[model samples]
Target: MNDIRVSDATQGAAKSAGRKRLLQWLHQIVFVGPATFFFILIVLIPFFLGVYYSFTDWNGISRNINFIGIENYTHILTKDPDFRNAFWFTVRFTVVGILLTNLLGFVLAYVLTKPIRTRNMMRTIFFMPNMIGGLLLGFIWQFIFIRGFAAVGEATGIGLFNLPWLGDRATSFWGIVIVFVWQTAGYLMVIYISSLNNIPKDVLESAEIDGATRMQVIRHIILPLIMPAVTICLFLAISWAFKMFDLNLALTAGGPFKATESVALDIYNEAFTNNRLGLGTAKAVIFFIIVAIITTIQVRATKSREVEM
Candidate 1:
């Protein structure tokens, strides 16, 4: 009887453990199930479908699609000058945009973090551009470039303002860069400010007492400590600059002999304008791979530099 009672107790405990495990799993499934379902339904399905369609000769409106097996990719690499130019343009824009935005953002953050009477108002003024939609901002700036600048030039006789900003290749390139930096820098400034505020006051005071100059403290202490913020800012800047479309569309629409066309805009024109859906999808796949590789490397490199407080 004693043996039988011990066996029953052990069996009961095992059953209880099994039930608890089952309940935990059920709870997780309940909470995570809907999001997983939607993601698989929406993002995963469309992505796989797009990948499949990329290898075919589908015009995006046809019922029949024939598999072409890398022909589109080959053409994009060798025969397509437009795509090449657009890719080159995107590379240049991304490089310049990243450097300028990050530099300006850090400067703004450094200044605004100081105790100033008008810092809050200045911050709001700087960040207001980001609140406007990209397309809308592009149009607004377009008018400013076309009319506002002309008027100012007439009044002030400034050669810089009199030039055709949206009509020339060099000016259009810089015009896009200016708008991009203006729209994006403030957001990065906010991120940097947060990171700046979190630095321990004692460390800064110690550096000051040790006779460190402002630049020395920033270089040796602040930059290393706030590197995580740098990583986030770089990632955001890279993505924004690389995939810029709406602003490119509304501002210049790849004007001045398609000099400012970005890879994204080229893909759009290929897919819809030229009705080369398969080829466009191929370009998109290539674009996706490049962006993924670049962002991964950037994150890994930056994360390695992050220092503990």
Candidate 2:
């Protein structure tokens, strides 16, 4: 009788364990399954299809596609002067944009962290430009550059405002830079503020007690503690500057002899305007690889400098 009872107890325990395992599996499927399915459908499938289409000669509207191997890639690397020019222009713009935006953002964040009377109001004012969409902001600045500056020039008799802001190569390049920095710096400033706020007050107090100068404290203490924020800000700045498209379109439209054409804009023109889907996808693949490599290197380099608090 005892053996019979023991067998019945073991069976019950095993059944309970099996039901618990089944419930956990069902819970995971309920929560995670939908996201996984959508990600594969939307992102993964399109990406693989793009990779396959890059080797074929398919116009945007064509149903028939002929495989062309590496011809598009070779043509881009060797013969496409426009793509080359756009690539170089993008490289230069990214470098300048990243540097200026980060520097200005850090400065704004540092100043706002002080015991100022109007710091909150000042932050809101600075960050207001970022709230506007890039396309709208570009249009607003276009008017400012063309009409507003001309009016200011007339009133103030300033040659700087009178110069054709978007009509020339150098001025147009700097024109975009000015607008980009103005729009993005405030966003980065918010990130820096969060990081700066998290820093221990005791550490700063100790540094001050050690007779360290303001600059010295910043260099030796504040910067190291905030390296993670620096890394994040650099990544965001790099991505923004490199992938600049809408603003480039609305502002210059790759105009003034295609001097400010970015890689993203060039890809758009190739696929949609030029009706060469395969070639454009090839360019896109290259652009993705370049951006991935650059951001990876930047992250690794900055992460290495991160100090443990």
Candidate 3:
């Protein structure tokens, strides 16, 4: 009887354990199943399809898809001068845009953090541009560049405003740069402001109580403490610069001899406009690889420099 009772108890315990395991699995499926399903259904499947399509001569409409191996990649790499031009243009724009956006953002953040009477108002005014859609903002700035600046130049006799901003290669590049900086800097400024606010007041006080000048405190204490914000801002800036499409579309439309054509826009034109979906997909794959490499490097480098309080 004692042996039988012991065996019954062991079986009961095993049943309980099995029930608990079942419940745990049910919980996970209930919570995580939908998101996983959608991701696999939407993003994962489409991405793999795109990869497969890149090797085939699919014009995005034909019923037939012929596999041509690496011909598309070879053609893009060797013969596509437009792609090369767009790549270089994007590179230059990204570099300049990153620098200006971050610099202006940091400056605005630093100044706005001070106790000024109109600080809140100034912040609102600065950030209002970001709230506008990129397409609308580009159109608004187009008017400003074409008409408003011309008027201002006429009124004030400023040659800078009178130049053909969107009609020339050099001026069009700078015009886009100006609008991009104006649109993006405020968002970065807000991020910087949050970072600036989180810094311990005691540290700044101690630095000040020492013989540290304003610049010294900022350089040593403030800058080091805010490296995380820098990392985030740089990543965002890089992504924005690289993926700039809507503004490029609305503002320049790759005009002035395609001087302002970006890689995104070029890929778009190649795929849809020229009906070379396979080649376009090849370019997109190359672009994706480049962006991934750049962002990874930037994140790692900045992450290494982040200092903990």
lDDT of each: 0.96, 0.95, 0.94
Clashing pairs in 2: none
Candidate 2 lDDT score at position 202: 95
150-224: candidate 1 lDDT, tens digit per residue: 999999999999989999999999999999999999999999999999999999999999999999999999999
On lDDT, the candidate that comes out on top is: 1
Model 3: per-residue lDDT, tens digit, 111-208?
99999999999999999999999999999999999999999999999899999999999999999999999999999999999999999999999988
Going through the candidates in the order shown, the clash numbers are 0, 0, 0
Evaluate model 1: give its lDDT.
0.96
Q: Which runs of model 1 end up more than 4 angstroms from their true locations?
A: none
Name the candidate, 1 or 3, with the larger lDDT value: 1
How well does candidate 2 score on lDDT at residue 260? 96
